[model samples]
Target chain A: MKAEAGCRACRGSCCGNPLVAELRGIPCNRRILLVGNPNVGKSVLFTRLTGVHAISSNYPGTTVGFSEGRLAFGNSCFHLIDVPGAYTLDPTNEAEDVARRIVDEGAEAVIVVLDSTALERNLYLALQVLERGLPVVVALNMVDEARHKGIAVDASALAEALGVPVVPTVAVTGQGINELVRALEERTRRAAPEAHSPAETTPPATLRSAEERWLVIGSVIQRVQRVTHRHHTWRDKLEDASVDRIWGGLIALAVILGSYSAIRLLGEGLIDHLLDPLANRLLLPLLEKLSAALGGEGLLHHILIGRLVDGAIDFEQSFGMLTTGLYVEFVMVLPYVTAFYTVLSFLEDFGYLPRLAVFFDALLHRLGLHGFAIIPTLLGLGCNVPGILATRVLESPRERFIAATLISVAVPCAGLQAMAVGVLGDLGGRYVLIPYAVLAVSWVILGRILHLVLPGYSPELIVEIPPYRLPSPSGLLLKLWFRIKGFLLEATPLVLGGVLLVNLLTMAGIVQAAARLTAPLFQGVLGLPPEAAGPLLLGILRKDVAVGMLVPLGLSPQQLVVAVVTLAMTFPCIATFIVLWRELGGRRLAASMGIMFFTAFAAGGLLHALFSLVGR
Target chain B: MGRQSSNFNPEQENLFRRTDSEEEALSNPAASEPPHPRQEAGGLRCPLRDVPNGRRVRVVSLPRGESGARLEALGIRPGKIVTKLSGMPFSGPVALELDGRQIAVGHGVSRAILVEEVPEP
Candidate 1:
């Protein structure tokens, strides 16, 4: 009942606190858990069974939290929970801890998804799950990949050895899914009559040490698995080269540059060819008519269409809920977000991110973080919210704090980056690189400082580099759509509200008052006009709009660079601020905010002084 | 236990033979008293970080505590054969090929892992 309560609470959200389950009541038999080692297609199998997309990817720790869904089989529906992948029941990390807790809380049955290619290693966890004495049907996933690798697994032999039904499956192709579900249905049915009787079922075996479990797994593998020598395919060779010291570095460089170019090309193409045209032709006339119908002069008109520039609406400069709000969110920011998630989804499903992490581990260590921190940092480049959320993968609180803080301070989301490029592109290529260079330098230096000052040690990277797989185009599109939909849902209201707030504040003359109050810091210290304070203040709500606001001010290139850098390093946009609070909690959030403000002003003042000395 | 016996390919006979010797050494330390000349050439246990790339070696001992348990869960316990793939520059994590899977262990953890090279014929 406690586990059921936990599942109920986490029905929509993917995460549930283990402590809440501990304080509750008895266990029920309606909940079946899908468990496996990391990156072994458990999530995919979950999707196959329940038709719920659990966001499967080709790397470890993708499901840092659990997701629950329902499986209806033969008129008997059961609650299916997709547990985070764990190598062992013995907790090693947060994800593993959650997995262990869910299993310990008891379930009706467990579906252990094992990788057929690496049966021996995978069997350790399977055997551990078997020892729990719960009914289990093993789904041997990725049989196709195993066959390609020259690994053969006799499903019947494995079933007999483990005394549980085993179904060979390829989750991506939907092969053998019906058989897997049928096997699960039969297994759970047979176990149901006495499932509630503790006396009828064998009690769970006492905890076995890692060595003892492996010994059992070894013998089990000897009976049912075989590996034959096979020539290395091109995929294998590419996988090897991607992790090689020299080639890995070169490939990493190319991948980074290539991804950047692709995102820019796709983003700008979307704007120029699709979104911009649709907006100007379709949406502009509607807005103009609305502007006229509202008399285009009162406070309400001002709030809706903003001020008319030369008797017409300038989408960028018109600070209205409808004029600038929709333009910034839909035309400017969404294109880049779409481009970013597309590329990132491909890289994730291709298993390239872990290699990138491995390649950068050494350098990241100096920053008081390990290589896995790179994943979160990469996610931060797309959006700071997911980047901060991905910090759950890191083991230690110290590493999470450091990574989250560094991301909030240094990493500019796609929206901010696109706006920065848009504003600075006209100045020159070199001017565009200024904020990037400053952020990069600060990333390293700030990490070094955090590493030295943080009392606890940052754990070293210990991660599996999954073999490369060709990502399915359908899967890539699904993930891209999922992320884009999430962005539109979360960002639309905030952008519109931000514009409305700006209009209301400006009308109330509060903007002028705040600008005057911060004039000393803006004018005397950062060498910017006080009017710049409004945009900088607006940066906290929506960064891209804040940066876009600067276009109308006509600031010199140097002043624009200073303001952009300060805005980036200062308070993260409110979405990121809330996520930071949730992830780091209140105390560390305060500390992180402190670090942010200090870094923003320090970097801003320093860059301002440097620019003045160079006579820019 | 019994070396898993899953590798039936003839090309891996040499690897099985090496595992036999390693098992013998583990079971009867005195019987292996007169160390093979190849073993002498390979030297005694050294940190895994110093092992040459592509050299097949047995993990002698892992760093104690949670890190050791973590490695063991991935099939890198003592006596398990693993090949050093490559180490990153500037003392980065070392990549090891274990049972057809690549695992990256941090430099510090790799240094604490004691290993001895398996002689090549």
Candidate 2:
């Protein structure tokens, strides 16, 4: 079923011209694709044209999936497909393959976006698209930056050189979009001229030698661009250190540690100052009131606000879907997720991700993975669902499987980590570090094991390091808003649904049956009680609530560490489970889960045994 | 794709290192009559992996198919000047700068590439 779905999705994409058009609300059946080299603001263009929030960043390989939106300009609106960025139609990577396939399927016309700063290199893609004989319009994006760098591109001269219409605009600011639309409209009008008039527009120099293309580009650049000497700037100095062998690694480390500390500080502060007061003082009473209004001892009341402590609301230990689930999703997970992605967005916008990829290139290479794995790993630190989605940036399936598996088992998402800190911090700070320590060592060992077992090697890193820019504040906030919105959308329903499911099962005696079945393993292997099984079971749903489940169990410090570690390492939450099932097929997902269980049990048992030995 | 192999053999160091007088002599054929010792080194072909850091080399050839095609699209081709930046410890991959762009070349692909040292200005 999984493989069939994968094939159908590919076919939909490969032959996806009309279908994709209709889905994005074209209605007229006319579609246009936005194509360009990676990281050149094609997504920003998509958002500008269609108003869809496609994530845009300064680094390459961000747009791995093709997004769609509708443009209602004039009486005629066409579906616009934001094709993933590729260098040429001759594809090397999976993302590039998708880009080439979209172009081959044909569109009414193509709007090829080019980075004005790198005109010649960016034009290489444009020339290939023009050779395909589609009506073309050129968008010279980032023109402001080009001018700032003492480089000027004569837009009219470039249009004359390429025999196409060129519109110079900043996609970020929606500048020149109207001019671009005008050029596009003209191309469409010229494409289907009269009833009997065939061959409306001729293909531009269909087959040219690479040498010939270079000659044309060279001449065109000479005519259009005027570069003047400039003094070295601060941006240039930072760009140098970002890729320097020694300093590069240090800067990456500093950025990572700083972000981690910030996430903890900020996440904890919000919960302590904002969320705790709101939940404890205001929201908890409202929920308890609802519980009482619905017959305080009834199942609905029990499910919503579980038995209150001493006739008052207890936020953490309530086990109520309304209380803990909502609190965990909004207050705990959201804050850390927001803090994490804020720093991540800054790094991505500042063009530091590619540099970090370069720094980890060697380390990942040794584990049969490439450097790009760092992106998914970093995202995993925030949430596992997006991390699994981000694995598409990697070029190979072998690397994707290993990366997804390692992330699910070892990387505790911020949702789970914040709860762990809250529950374990009460015992002592040292106990809080245990789960993370266990995660770090398990990642290396499990990675080595996966490397030894998995067949085939990951592709070598061959990525471009985009230059640094002072990230625009508006862009940063827009990107962050979409990300947090996405988190809330995915996190809320699944967490609430999971709580409901667990409550129903507990009422039906099913939870008792399952807990009895796993009792011996829970007691003998992990040194935890039979009732601890419920949180372990629901850990697959919402990890934060699962960690909170441990608080009411009154387990010692060592046992608390064992249970949290086991919960984190066993499997990702249901949202991530679905995403992994989609990304990797059923068979690979099963193998991954099998490995997770084996490792979780083995590590849990080992920790329990060692800690017991020390206690004696 | 067809690749044109250079006739020159690569020289590690020695007479090839100091070629200013020789280049100047070559400009005037009459003064370059001392039997051009470095003439044979002009066609100096070697794998990109062997190119020393800070030395510029022009791409001489590449194997055909995906690898060659990808390199070409990325602006790495015959006569393109590339300067070595940093190489991985185990002949893994070499970081190179060409056309003011930085890219990492893998172990196998870089080995398949044959280049000759470009003379400095």
Candidate 3:
């Protein structure tokens, strides 16, 4: 299952059969596995074919698990499995191996999705899949992209040469989905023939080598494909230079920063002016009355109503289930998450991410990582767990280590971002620049230092730059919807449960006791109050709780920045830490945590000292 | 086909299986050296040896991708010479200019891609 160098003899795992155990309970529906390289439209087609909800984002590594759903074509029902995108069957990493194993285990059939625009590269995988002698139907995706680029494909001719079905599809719009479903039906009706047929059960003496596979593909392509002359697109020449040039990098960086800022401003403005009023003015009052009727003082009441003090809902300490946690997460965090994902999906689907990666590759290389590492680093803006997990794409352990370290130490998650934008914008509109400056400086310094200190070789960049295509609106919307739903669910339960837990801890006087116990550390070392320790403790649970805790302390703009920055860099929320522990192992995780804790304190102390120096 | 290493994994063995009857056909030593159908460029000469690294040469031809026509249409087929602009220090990737277009190709892929040196103006 390992892909060693120059191992041409190794047929990829995608082109092999494993085994499948029949389920004794439910009727084993027609199981189809969607397998292909990363960034191909596998997830989109999976969603279209089976109507399954899989997160289909622009960057790689969004769909990390095998999601299952059903597709009903007429009276027939087929169960579909959407797997992680993989490059080669050689199983280079964990995710690739997961996909390999899924294919090895029997499925009714597999749809080898190929991007028509990158036909040759895409065909490499398709040829490998076909050699497996599995019941595979080639889903030639992005045909529209190809046509837009002046490449025309003869589907029937390709099908004839491949000795299997070839279905052209535009998964983003659900185009050719019915035809794909029909192709799958045809495959299932054939009952997945064994190798024992006239195809020779004993296996051939000389299997098709990689070169021969390409030759066969070339011949088939020669018969079925034609291209009319189109003027060379600007993207072809400008793409590499845009990110590769010095000035282009600066411009790209500015564009990225400006886009993020605009998204935040527009997102917050809409939510604050529109969504918040709906949630706060309409929803909260009704929820409070309902909790009142449910006997507003017991466990359920505390869980639902929170600590009601002096009348109106105290956005903070209203530590009730339905009132505080749900409201804060959904009303405050969800809208912004939705907006961020919408913008992210467009950037991803349009094929700009690779260029951005190319732009940042040189800078990242200084930190012992390549440009591909930008995927995880950007995701870290939203959350660290996925960011850490996304590091699986990094080829070297050293690059992953540095990437994980930098993200944990500097990158602020979405929740922290929301809090920063809200509080800092209100206090001193320009004060927001302070955190950005601090983070950027810290990132550069730390990244440079890590580049020197980290022990690993950074591989040279050779990434495939996909051509730009106009992103499908439905595709982008569906992607945004999927991620936003996941965020709400993941955050809502944790936030509400965290609120309840914090409430219980307060009622039992543990918050006071713990706050007192950590008083010296919070006050002397970090120069924040002991009460801030409570929020710091809750910050480990959910950043929202930590930011919520900050409200009571009533700190100045400088103090707020210090506390927020410290909290952000100190320790990620419990979930993220667990992922770090899993990815880096306990020892590395402990070391990372220890390094982060000290850095957070030292950094806060330094910032405080500098502010005082300027003040005098 | 190049000779594979004797150490084959079980998974790989399963993929490139050999049948008893077909083994006899493969036993002929001459069968091992498959025909190279690609038209070798130049007259009164064998395959060029020791094409120095970083030689500014245009690619006279290219080994196309899985879809050969698309690569051919990109002006990458025969007679479209390329220049070797740079290469990694330890015989790694070589950057080349072909038909006024530049691409970085790996050493293995580059070596197979036959190139005639571009004469200096």
TM-score, one value per model: 0.90, 0.86, 0.76
Extract clashing residue pairs from model 1.
Answer: A1-A26
Instruction: Tell me the TM-score of model 1.
Output: 0.90
TM-score of chain B of each: 0.64, 0.64, 0.46
Candidate 2, residues A255-290, lDDT tens digits: the string is 889988987788778878887888778887789679
Query: What's model 3's lDDT at A88?
Result: 57
Which residue pairs show backbone clashes in model 3? A18-A104, A303-A321, A306-A319, A306-A320, B57-B82, B57-B83, B58-B81, B58-B82, B59-B81, B59-B82
By TM-score, the best candidate is 1
Fraction of native contacts (fnat) of each candidate = 0.51, 0.24, 0.01
Q: Judging by TM-score, tell me the better candidate of 2 and 3.
A: 2
Off by over 4 Å in 1: A1-27, A191-204, B1-43
Q: Lowest lDDT 10-mer window, candidate 3 chain A?
A: A1-10
lDDT of 1 by residue, B26-58 (tens): 343322235445555666778788888888898
- Here, model 3's chain A TM-score works out at 0.85
Ranked by lDDT, the better of candidates 1 and 2 is 1
- The digit string of per-residue lDDT tens for model 3 on A66-157 reads 66655544434445677687765556455667777776665678888977766655676666666666677889888987887788888887
Residue A546 lDDT in candidate 2: 85
Candidate 1's displacement at residue A400, Å, is 0.4
Question: Taking the tens digit of each residue's C-alpha lDDT, what string does model 1 give over A463-551?
Answer: 98898989999888888888998899988988898888988898899999999999998899899999999999999999998998888
